[model samples]
Target: MSSGALTAFILRSPVFAGLLCFFVCAGPCPGREDDQARVLYARAQKLLSEGDPDEALDRYLTLLKKHPRTEWSALSLWDMYRIYIHQDSPEPAFEVLNRLIVEQPGHFEKAHAAQLQLVQRILGSGKEARTNLESVKKKKPLPPEIVVEMLKTVIKNGPHSEVGIQAHYYLAIAREQAGEKTEAIAAHEDFAETYSSHELADDAGYQSAYIAYKSWKSMRSTGPHQRENAAVALAWFIARFPESDKAAQARSCLAEVRAAELSELLGLARYYEARSNPKAALIYYQQIASRFPEVIQTDEVLRDKILSLKGAEEVVGPVR
Candidate 1:
């Protein structure tokens, strides 16, 4: 239709006339360009409602370029991302939503939800990265090397997001499980220290203590008593958060270490006794009884200390 004929048809259409009258002035317009953008945007919404996303997206993009702040541009972009998600193209959806998070933090919840949906979909599909991971698992148990590599990927890509701590924690656990005790201890320590103020601080602290205790226990024969190390780690947790709910746990762990130390002293006493060194055995037993009087084995240790001292005194014929 000719422009004049089309105008006449639009004037005859109640919907078109209503929109024009509501949005456009009857007099000469100084901001006619902006009004034209609004008209296009309204038409895009209409097309989207009518199930014409292709055309709707085209017009929305045009409107955005023409008048980026038409008050509906953010919504337009959000809609585009939603459409991408519905189409099962989550990569682009996540990208757009992530950009929205950075560009408009007030809308971060919406963007974060969208991104989480995309990640879940990707994981649920059992494809891409997830597929490869599943496939590898089917072939053989994941080696320490592979687990570490996977964790590193999450850490490197997820720093600005909440995924960093998760990745690091997983890697640390994987390392510990794979018998890489030293590396696991280091990883847990770093994660707990670096993200102390993060949302995952408590979780990190719990895991750090748990992992360090286990790793140190397993590696004790190499020197530096493992129970002592575990005690030190528990102390760190307790000192850092004195009133934490985990304080009870830390106290229990400290008690275990104290008991272990007493056990070590008793073991040394037994060794001296076996070697027929009554004086040394007596001294070690007395040390355990005196220093660890609150230990669970305190009563037995005190009786042993008395017997050892009496035996040593008889062997030495009453020392002055």
Candidate 2:
């Protein structure tokens, strides 16, 4: 049982000698580091499949750091990217994805395309977030705070990039959907200003005006200030986008606002006339006739009213 006897015995047997040669030539046993990495990768995948993504993410990160050159490293990075996306942390997800694309283009091409498709879907360039809509209806939509964070990331990091433009557009839609009219208008305006040459610029401009008009309509009481704001928005839209598809609608809204102003002036004139203030009533009627001549027959009626008021004042000797 001495070492020399054992070696001799092994060398004397053809089968044992062949097995030893094969083992030596095939290379040393797989390293402990590789074994550890494999075990960790399997555990991470299991944790993810069991709905423990946070733990899975930690495990994957550990594997990547400890076994960077191992075969599992690329796969671990990809899985981590998926988890980040599922958590709505697109910034980190993008980081991981870019790394994967740089390190293993052939392996990650499909994943990169999938990520782009997801972004397009959320931005309504695709089927309008089918999964997201379902999640919303089920009361399980991704956290709004997280979405906001992701949007901010896209805007800040890729402002002039294609994804950034889409992100801006999507942010405006999100604000509108949440009933944040002022915020929506601001976002739309920002997109239009920042990406003037983009195809969506005209649409953004139109949406800004439309949102302003809608806000004006939803008010219980319309005043000069409200009318002025709405009128300005419509006028901007009309002048800036006369050739736009929404131009007709913008012009109609403008006319409605102008008519409301004319009606208001007419009401004031009538009220002054009823109160025996002929001079004041005449001023109002004349103002309307001069300012709104395009109001159809109303211009002639306003002029006639002005003349009658002046006549009444002259006959009454300007009653105070």
Candidate 3:
């Protein structure tokens, strides 16, 4: 139809005019899509302001379907995510947020801000969560899965924020509580590496080393290799956090590991001595005297033992 005839038809039949506008104005109006999207977006926001989130969600979804490539669609998706979060449905919120992030990379900060808000809503204020964590020493006292999801969200969305740092710290605790020592250590390490300037960085490092130390210490038959790893971890903790409150404990742990190593060496020396292999026994005794003199039960006793072993080996012709 000619523009004039269409205008006349629109002017003559209001119902038809309304139907025409619904289909034409609401559909893809190439050059006018931006204006149309703005109008639709305003309507959705109005619905939301009027406490009709269900209707607002419908309008936002319709806006997306009609103007999928328009900038307004990205805005609509973000609003939809907010709606889902308000409705306590994180699954859809995450879905919409993922789409918004991918479709509008420049809007990543907006999406990240929105995700942080959602996480805060889910987990409450950071101070409150921290207080609860400090008070509760039980394993998985908070919902592990939900806390884990929040941690992932913050780490992925706002890794440099205070919330992200806190999430990383709490995730380590949660993983440890859940008996995931390896994952806990990794999380603590990641936090320490990524946020070295953060106040909790030293604590994160300590937790990582302490977890490894505890695992090895609790073993029924701790081998030299395990002892070595645990000692290295404790030593790292001591070096990294010399002034930290945990430093003393770390030193003590290091001392215990060294003592264990020395004990193992002495046991080996005694075993070889029982077998009448003075040369082999002497090697072990010398290892204790030279490599672990500090851990020897007594300096004089270790020296005497080393000398006795050496004399016995010489008498046996060095076991050759």
Candidate 4:
């Protein structure tokens, strides 16, 4: 608007005065802006309560646009989201939520709380009204992006918070289900390390180690690298949570990984020997013997072959 018309409008309407405050003394007039926001919000609430939802929505939209950075904008966006959803306008409802989530950087707690309410409403509750485990147990979880946003808000608020800890664990789960195992592992490990005293700490730590282990174990063509990853993951879980209920399972998985690795090394050694490269064969055999002495000693035939290669390597010398 022209400066003249704008000034006239600002003078004519008390609500429009707040909009001009932004133009005249934006950063310096927080008190004015906040007070004006409350006025607008009260006006919107009265309109809504009087059954003039359309007018209430307009008031809220104006408040959001004029005082976007004020805390009242958060309430405005939330009310707008509710109104859109009540009207069955999915697109606008999503837009309002995105505005709260993405544009309003100051409302981390509000955003997270709103998301939880939305999730609870959409997914239907089980026996517990409040649970750290609800999202995972849902038959149809919210979309990955929504869960991610919720997690981000929770994390941004602070991991020491009760809700933040739950969010950290759930965020890893969401990433895992989205096939981002690397990110999932990192998130889970972070949660475990940062909240080692919490009740779910062991669960987080095991999941961190298990994601990579499970992937390697399930692969059709498990390479040496994959076996090594599996072994390391299982070993980590065993070390980190030695008293955990899952410790025995981790031990079993680690043994399987070791066995598979030993098999690969033995196969490589035989392949080298078949190629007339006894020097390379000796190296692999020695590695397998060194790494798996218990397993090798129980197999007399393999032990004898390693001894012979050692004898030959002593006479012929190492490959290098």
Give the winner by TM-score.
2
* Number of residue pairs clashing in candidate 1, backbone atoms closer than 3 angstroms, sequence gap of 3 or more or interchain: 0
Question: Tens digits of per-residue lDDT for model 4 on 1-320?
Answer: 99999778779997778777767875557798899999999999999888677899999989988988888888899888777656544345655766776888776566655554453343332122332211322244456666566556656656566766676777787777667889999988888888888888888888877787888878898566777877787788789889999888888878888878888888899999999888889889989888998968799999898888789878986556
| 1 versus 4: better TM-score goes to | 4
The superposed Cα distance between candidate 2 and the true structure at residue 31, in angstroms, equals: 8.8
Which is the winner by lDDT between candidate 1 and candidate 2? 2
* Poorest 10 consecutive residues by lDDT, candidate 3: 127-136
Model 1 global lDDT (CA atoms, 0 to 1) = 0.66
TM-score of each: 0.48, 0.65, 0.58, 0.60
lDDT of 3 by residue, 1-320 (tens): 99999889777998987887889777556779888889999999999888788999899989988888888998899778766655556557766876776778877766765655555544543322221111323232345566567658667766776655676787787677668888998989888887877888889989898888888878889666778878888888787778888788888888888888878888999999899877888888888878876655567877887887677767767333
Candidate 2 residue-wise lDDT, 15-56, digit = tens = 999998998898535587789899999999899888898999
Clashes of 2: 0
Model 1 stretches with alpha carbons more than 4 Å out: 1-141, 216-224, 274-276, 289-320
Positional deviation of residue 144's Cα in model 4 after best superposition, in angstroms = 1.8
Model 2: per-residue Cα lDDT at residue 119:
52
How would you encode candidate 1's per-residue C-alpha lDDT over 73-126 as one tens digit per residue?
A: 667678777655544454555566665666655677566644544443333322
